[model samples]
Structures are given as C-alpha cells and as structure tokens.
Target: MATILKRASKGKAGYGKIQFCGEQARRDGLQYFWVDTCCIDKSNACYVYLPDVSQSSSVLADNSNESWESFRKSEWFRRGWTLQELIAPASVDFFSREEVLLGNKTSLEQDICETTGIPATALRGSALSDFSVAERMSWTECRETTYKEDKAYSLLGIFDVYMPLIYGEGKDRALRRLREEIDKASRGTSLFKREDFSVSFSLSDVSDVEHFVARKIELVKIHKALGVDGSRRVVVLHGLGGIGKTQLTVAYAKRHKDDYSGIFWLNIKDENSLKQSFVKVAKQISREHPLALRLSNVDTNENLDDVVDAVKEWLSLLNNKRWLMIYDNYDSPKLPGKTDPTVVNIREFLPELY
Candidate 1:
C-alpha cells in the first residue's frame, strides 16, 4: 500500500494554514476532510480507515477515525485541495536537520528551491506527499556519511545515487575539479600556462616519456633551492625539440611560481625575435622602460648589445627578489658560420655572484 506521512510538530504557526484550508473545504459544503492528524491514530502509529456518519452523528461526536474516510470517497482526499494546501510543520526543520546531519555546510538562507528547482513556497508547506520521506532520509545520510566509513568504494559511489536530485547546475564545478586531478596524475608534469599557472589539461593530453615526472620533480627542487640561495643561478634547460625540455621548464616555473617574485618566458628563435621577446619580458617585469626612447629611437639603429644590457640591468635590480628567465627555442645560429649571439650573450649577462 502507498503511504504518505507528514512530520507533525505542535505549537507551530504553519500548521494553522492547513486548518484554514480545511475550514474552506467545510464552507464549500465538502462532507469530509482526509486530515492525517485526525484521520490516523498518531498514538498507535498505524494507518486506519475512517467511515461516515449521518446528521444524527454530530461533527464533534464523530471525532473517531471511522467517521471521516467513509464520508468522502475520493472527495475526502480532494476537499479544499488539502493534499496541495496542507502545511507540514516538520518539513523545513527536517531538511535543516538532514543538512546538518549530512554536513553539507550549505546555508539555511540559501534558496534550495532555486538550486533543487523545487518551488520555495511549495516546500514551505508539507504538501509533498508524492515524495518519499524515507528516500529523503537515506539521501541525507548518504551525503553526510564520509568516505572513511565506506572505504570499499569512493565518495563518487555515493554521489552517483543522489547526483541527479542534488546537483542541478553545480555538477559542472565538481566535474571540472575531477578533470584537473586526472590531468595532474596523467601528465606527470604539472605545467600548463593559462591565466593561472595551475595545470589545466587531463593526463590523456600529455605525451608518454620516460623520467618525465622525475625530471619535473627534480626541477622543482632545484628551483626551490635556488630561491633560498642569495645569489641568482641561470639554470639553462637544453635538450632536443619535443624531448619535453620546454615542457619541463614551464612546469617548473608554474610549480614554484609563487616563490619567485617574477617570471619571464622568452622564445629566442632568432636575433630580432629574441630581442622583441626580451623587451616584452622586460616591460612586464619592470613596468616601465628605463631607456624607452633610446630603444624606440630607430628601427635598425637599436643595437642588440644595448637591449641585452638593459635586460641584464633589470635582472640585476631583482637581486633582493627572486626571478625566473625562461629562454625558449634558443637553437638558431646568429649568422653564417657563427653561433647564436643571444645564447652567448645570455651566459655573459648571467654573472656568478660571490
């Protein structure tokens, strides 16, 4: 048998509204009201049917369970729309208790109606007979229970059951965090340069390479140790293209990004390109050009040495603060039968301090 139960609380104001609906039903000339409080034996906690009585049976005298249900067939359930209009005093308090017991940490002021897509006013009343109170109780317990208790399965196991009802649009945020964790595990190199240095891709996106994770971890340790050292060290990460060298440095920069005061990534593919990249990095770090007009005086008149000196001076000023200079793709030759001047100059600029 399908049963509907309402949590009743005495001395509550909302229950009076249910009584108002019942009075309206009586004024509308309805014969009987299927009010659970009067219809069911609350003392015994059992479902009992009530029968009808004639005019000889006064309404006050017909207070027994047998008189009410017999007076109205389906109409007993329909009188004044009590099924939709009745207020259950315990509805809000039950959900509040469930939320606390479940440890959801959601605010009581939060519009659960908006989040769950249930009408706020409808929930204010105890009119939801179609919903199962047992199911709600189980859901509350499942959410509040920690993974430590259910060790055999992860929290995802519990989430799968109630996700449909509980998570409306908020499911996306949970999925996004999950994807980030999966990516961090799979990539082995926590390096992705978005607006935030936090890794963004999943493990499936990273290439399979031996010692990739180890190499990145070692780089992080080196970066940390270098940060502590009063003197700056220009650690050049060099390897064949696509050997994951750039990826390693980028990952290192991202991991220890907070430790360093500033980080500059320069792609030194050619002489002119390298100079432009350095100027951009210089501007980002220093925020103002020390020799702005001189550098912008003429297009071809700008000497590579001067630009390199400016970058060196900027690095020098950051002696009290830690900084990272990432020189990417520094494999090109400067001229015919000549080594890249940019690489040679970078080494010269990064002087070892005593």
Candidate 2:
C-alpha cells in the first residue's frame, strides 16, 4: 500500500511536520507517500515531533476575540483548501502542492492582517514561524502613515489658499493647476523624468541665444579635455542672468549626461537656498543627509558651515569618478560668506572657478 502522508493546512505546518508524517507512513509499510516537505528533502526522519504551538497560541489568544475575528476574516481559512483537506493524503497531488499551499498562506496572511487589526500568529498557529510578524506590521504601518500624510494636503485644502484661480479654470487649466499643486507638495523634486534626460529651462522665448548648440560644443570640449581618466573638472559658464546662462547649463547637462556616470545640476539663487539644495542633492546621491553626518541640530539660519563641509567631503570621495556640478544663477548676495574661503577669493564666487 502507498504511504499516507498528512500535511497541516498551509499556514499550520512547517517542513519538519510533513517530513515526519511521510517517514511515519513509510515505517508503517506504505510504498509511496506524496508529501511536499519530505519529497523536497532527500533525508527523511520520523522521530521529529510537531513544533510547540503554545507560544504562538499565547500571542493569538492574548486577544482572543480579536484573534478569532481575524482568523475568520483571513483569506487562508475562508478560501479553497480546508485544514482537513491539507492533512488528507488522498485530497491533493504530490507535485506542486506545497507551492500552491505556501502562496495561499502568504496572500491570506497579508490580506487578513492588513484588513483586521490582529496578530498573524494567532490565526495560523506555529506553522509559519520563520516569517517575521513585526517586520510585516512595520511595513503596513509605514504604508498607512504615508497615505494619511498624503490626505493632509488635499485639493480642496490647497484650493482654499490659491482659491479663485484654481476654480476658475477649465479641465486643461485645472490639470495644470493640479500638477503645480502636486509638484509643490513633493518639494519640486519631480523635475526629472525617467524616460529622457533633460533639464527645465526658462529660456523658451530667447531666439538669439542658440543655447542648445553653444552648450553642446562646450560640453564636448570639456569632456575631451577632462579625458576618461576620472578627474573632477569645473567649467564655469558665467554671463548676465537673462543672457541664457541657465539655458546653456541645462543644455550642457542634458547633452553630456551619458558621458559621466553621474550628473547633478543645482540652482543656488541665495545662500540659505544653496545650502538646503546641496543637502538635498547629497542625500539623493550618497543616501546620507549632509546635516545628519555631523550636526545633530539643524535650523534655517544656523550658518551653513556644516553643509559646505559635507559637500567638500562628498566631492573629494567622487574625485575618482567623472562628475559635473553646474551651479546655476550662483551670483546672489551673501554668496561669499556661504562658500569656502580657501576655494576662492572673498570678493566674488567667480574666482573659485578659475
């Protein structure tokens, strides 16, 4: 007679339980038994006992009513294979049974735990002991927090401040307003699109500038002179504000983005803004906030000495990799005090480039 192996419901038994059952069946004069856990493992043993269910039961029954409610709501218990069917050898096929059971267990746990405020262990017992309940709880909590955060800044709420203009618009105009609102909420960080490498420029109406052509040539020359040896080089394109300085920089960045491994463009219109922008850029590239590196206490006007130090440190590390740092509209007042004195003369930030 073929061996009869019993498997606990997907979430109620581990590999050891299934293996023990198969081994027991074989010892009882059965020729073959379809057991996922034992079949998947080469060496099989019968002495192993089912894992202790007391710990998980305590966690679940600590809040008995809640646990029962959660268990009832659980997709695993409510759906296809019953606990009896899982343990019945004649009910399921040997091949691929484990996969289907495990998938169902996982999906059910996630769905039930998310919908009902219940501890997962109580619903399925000690079967899925290896999975971390705390980690799943943390992830679910984070998602909930993010959703609630997004709700605080609703369209109606923002419209109250920018009112008449937002409501007086047509569908296309309303969409533009909505985009601006979303951009503001995201701190204007949505400037880059993944599909194409391009920078935002306000020189759309400038005809005589020929910004794109001029910057492309400059970028090629800069890349060639810098060579592929991976040395950091600074090319300062300084001119009057409206004379396409920003446009030229944006064009250069887009054209030569592929030449370098990483490219970052920053608009430093003021000293404080410059510091904040640098910190943001540093966080994006290095995964560490500049202020968090050394200073614990950070405020708006607390002197950006820490920020300048952080940027210098990051730049030194990246000296081995080719990078371009475009400082757009950097001629604002208070620039001298914000920049490093060792880098250039205090009279103007322009001398730093030289």
Question: Per-model C-alpha lDDT, please?
Answer: 0.40, 0.40
RMSD of 1: 23.1
lDDT of 1 by residue, 1-354 (tens): 012115655357545534443454456465454544443221211111222213123432545544332332323222321222122232211111111111111222133332233344434432333332222212222122122222112222212122222333343344343334433533443232111111112223223454555465678666755664546565656567887776676567656766665666666666566677666654443322211223323233356666666656645643334555667777753445676345434454452343
Predicted structure with the largest TM-score when compared to the true one: 2
List clashing residue pairs in candidate 2. Answer: none
Evaluate residue 311 in candidate 1 and report its C-alpha lDDT on the 0 to 100 scale: 58
Q: Model 1, poorest ten-residue lDDT window?
A: 94-103
What are the models' TM-scores? 0.32, 0.36
Structure candidate 1, residue pairs in collision:
51-66, 51-67, 88-126, 102-144
Root-mean-square deviation (CA) per prediction: 23.1, 20.8
**lDDT (0-100) at residue 343 of candidate 1?**
44
Model 1 regions lying over 4 Å from their true place: 1-216, 286-304, 332-345, 348-354
lDDT of 2 by residue, 247-342 (tens): 655666556567665565554666555566566554444332211233223232455655555544545442225555656666743454577532
